[model samples]
Target chain A: MIYEEVLSGHQQELRRGTVVMAALATLETPGYGYGLLAVLEKSGLSVDANTLYPLLRRLEKQGLLDAEWDTTESRPRKMYKTSQSGRSLLDSLTAEWNYLATSLNALRSEEPNTPLKELP
Target chain B: MSSLSSRYVTAVSRSVPESQREDVEAEVAAAIADLREARLDAGTPPEDVERAVLLELGDPMRLAADYSNKPLHLIGPDYFPTYIRLLKILAATVLPVVAFAVMLGKLLSGGDAGEIASGGIIAGLGVAMHMFFWVTLIFALIERNPGSKEAKPKWDPTTLPDTPPGGVRLGDTIAAILVALVAVAYLPWQHFNSPFTDAQGQSMPTLNTELWPFWIPLLMLGLLATAVLEFIRYRAGGWSWRFVAINAILELLVAVPVVWLAATDSLFEPRFIGRLVTEGWLDASLHLNVTIIIITIGVVIWNLIDPLRKVRRDTAMRAKRVGSLG
Candidate 1:
């Protein structure tokens, strides 16, 4: 049980950074909250519906995502897509992530016996 | 369209801003409907899907918090340190001084020891509650209104001044100790051979001589503690939790006896007051005891306010430095 809790915590920390990247990548194509959730799940990032909805709203509010209500559908849906600035931010973040990943890989190769320090 | 979905939307809308309530309600409702449609397409029963979709959305209040983008905390991390520092200053200084005043007032008015103590405690607590309520309310308002001018400035290490070698200067501490020593030594002597004398050639001491045995020793102990605190402050160079704790203890030690003396009406020499009142040297109706108590309370308040003001000045200066750098 303890090991499971620790593993879940580590998984959460790992997913935290990817969630933003995943959201930006997926929202390049306009999608509503539920549809975006499905997309994220298919992409192996299973975010809670409540979490995704708010995150989408926050991103839109921050001008990183553009949102529009598609009333042509039977049920009106607030569809979201990545904004121009959001695309630029995504590019920068991607570059940073790649650099960080490479550095981590180099470190791991150098010290195979050293374990990552646990967060308090 | 489901009752459960409607209820959930209503709960969320209630907690959001009045201007955005309608928009939020419509958006949340649409999201729920979309989830229900997906479930129905997967062959789930309508009633089960409705319940499941609402449950998956989680708590409405938490959803509202995210929607608002405002802190749920009474005091956010930004202003929390300032809040704590202000609280300590009030607790150490304002509380004891107010308590002392109330006790003094009760004593002059002929209140018994128990009555005086209780009154002082009640008054102290009242002031503390008042301080806490207003402080929390202001901080909460600042938290809710994020872009307000009262918001904490961006922190920078360069903004911090080099900490002085000691918080309390050696000269100041020595001067205070000397003054305290004089006052302590003079109290007993003054009790017996007061500068003021009656027509009958008997010395009319200001304070009741009967209280000397208990009062003088207590006063000496308090002064000694104060001297030690000053030394500690001089050595430490800045306010720490330990320094604040010791300061509070010393304040209480000093305040209790002074308060007790005043409350029990044992501060003034009755004979001296009576002689003066009879000889027309003093006004018969003048509330000398009450006036003395008021002066003591005023002095305590002034002392307390002075240090707090300096701390505030220092904080403002640092904030100004950071602002300039930005």
Candidate 2:
């Protein structure tokens, strides 16, 4: 019973930071909350609305995402677009992601009997 | 916004700071409406969408917490390990030492058993509570304060302890030999030119003069044996089972008899006790024999266990290295 919980916990942890990276990258183009969620979900990156909304505000607070009220629609919505810093952050995060992917692949390909050191 | 969405947004916004309150409420209301609209457009009935959207958003209090950036945990992962490590250190070290001192002070000052127990236990618990409370408070504060992160010393692998291979440290052996030699010299010197004086002004050794014939010399021999054993340990560079056995025997040879003699009130000159009492140093009726015996027993137990523990550790370390090499 606990094993399932443990596995899911690990999977959630693995996806946690990637959610942030995904939001930052996708919001480079201006998008409303629902649109952003749908984009993320369609890309197989499901995020909780509660998590994403606060995270968007936090990113804006950190001067990463610029928020604007769009009253053009029948219902007013907050549109978010990544700021210059957010773009740079996304770039660095993408680079880090690639590096990690390569490292993980290298590690996975190694035989079990191989010396246990130097993941980095 | 629907009533449920309005309530959820209200709940989340109330806890947010006023500067951002109206903005967050508006954003949440818009998001909920969008969610409801999208689901309704996808052919879900309008009645179910509001509650579903609110449920999908999760608890409003958690959303508020996320916005406020205050961690829900008192001690998070960053500081938890350090907090626990320091707590264990305080428990193992400061708590016992302070408690022991409090108890000893109460004992020496002649408290009743209840008073001693209360004084020591209460003081110990108070210290432990303060250690925990303050350290936790400090870590919690540090966790919240962003600047304190940089203030912490950066950990480096070089700081790891690198112990030498041999079990018998040269300094320890030398110190042990010196202690034995000093006791050997001091015993005879004290016997000859005694420090304490009886009522007649004749020098009286603090130790019973009667002990000089058999017990004192035997104790001296034990000390000499310890010195020889220490020297052998130093030369051998590690403890074998044989060495540990002999070390235990040498330790018990001195400690057991001394503890027995002290317990029987034969170790000290009776006159010396009376003199101390007259000087108002010790309570006249108090029994010091138990204290001496306990301390001696504790020391002997420590002495016997220490070498054996070290030897076991050294053997394990050696075996690990050999296995790894093979």
Candidate 3:
């Protein structure tokens, strides 16, 4: 019932789904899980290894992500990328999201609250 | 424990698949290290920091659940309500029956009626328990919407088993039934009809109960049918509502003989509850009987619900995939 707790939990879950798409989008150029997390954070997404690792797996399972081991370093790191199918799906989801957002905005603007009048 | 940590990580890693473990462990290890560093920055005591980090990591059971996308309960969201309702209904039927069996055992042993509450209270509690379970189940189901990824963790099927191993094979089930027959049928019949008498010349209760011969074969046949069905499942891809249908048929078959015996005053004498009070051995026998019936029914219903629900889900998923392609 704590408002901050509820807000943060809700926000965390909301971001988790998008993390897959984000990872794939970033991995259009090959990056590992930690690398992807860093990219996400740089892009203002703020993902951690716990969250990113599972998202990577889910995306890979869906055949939207592909991985290969990079053992050249002292420790091997699995690098991932956006698969062909993944790119196509990402494009579709992105377009659909934008369209949905536009429609939602139109619907909200028509509401009788007169907040539009108060706005410059 | 710090030295053992890598082993623990490796064990957990192996518990998943070989392909995913190393990277997953590295990430997990990094997160642990990060938490440790953060604790150090906060100037937390060294001893407390390790414990805090461990606690913050959460239980490995939950971590595995997170990784595997395992729901808290065996049943999925869609069928959870119906499953809970069925459990409630079964629990309702089972409680008073068990209570009655217990009460009968007590009564037959010359215990006071006051010691046993009337059947109404038991029945009511059973119904209430049933409703409570279903209500919670319905709420949980309603809460599960794919649109809302709120508590839904992203699931990767590649790291998980294609199918859960939580199924009873027909052969093993058959073997269990055979064991039950030996214990319930052969041993008791041998004891009851054995030519030898005890020192007091009073024979053990043995298989003198009229329900003995009929119940044994009836139960065994039920189990045998299940074994055969599981065999078919192992050999083939599809085994639909066979488990449930078979169980229901067995229950009906057993019920008829049970009702007849009870009505004719041959069984349920002084009630199974009265027997519990009268003969401690009888109490134990009834306990075993009730346990077997309850377990069989539970397993059958669970088996029935999970597969059919999965079939529906897979069908829906396939449709979605096709739709997406189109």
Best by DockQ: 2
> Could you tell me the lDDT of residue B141 within candidate 3?
61
Give the Cα lDDT of each candidate.
Answer: 0.79, 0.85, 0.61
Instruction: Tell me candidate 2's interface RMSD.
Output: 0.8
Model 3, position B21, has a per-residue lDDT of 66
- Give candidate 1 misplaced runs (Cα > 4 Å): A111-120, B41-45, B153-326
- Candidate 3 Cα misplacement greater than 4 A, ranges: A111-120, B1-4, B14-58, B73-76, B101-111, B114-326
How big is the positional error of residue B193 in model 1, measured in Å on the Cα after superposition? 24
Ranking by lDDT: 2, 1, 3
Write model 3 residue lDDT over B54-170, tens digit each, in one string: 565556555544565546564566555455555666666766577677667767777677755554466457666766676666555644544533654344557443654333455
Evaluate model 3: give its TM-score.
0.45
lDDT by residue (tens digit), candidate 2, A1-120: 999999999999999999889999899889988999999999999998889888998999999999999989897989999999999999999999999999988878888547565454
Residue-wise C-alpha lDDT for candidate 1, range A1-120, written one tens digit per residue:
899999999999988888788899888988888988888888778998888888888888889999998989776889899999989989999999999999989887875655555323
lDDT (tens digit, per residue) of candidate 2 on B42-102: 9888778888888888888888889878677787877787788789889999998998899
lDDT of 3 by residue, A1-120 (tens): 699999999999777667766877889999876667657878999875555666676777789988777778756567788999999999988887789889889868786666667787
Q: Per-residue lDDT tens digits of candidate 1, residues B20-70?
A: 799789889988888888889989987699998888898899888888775
- Among the candidates, what TM-score does chain A have in each? 0.89, 0.90, 0.82
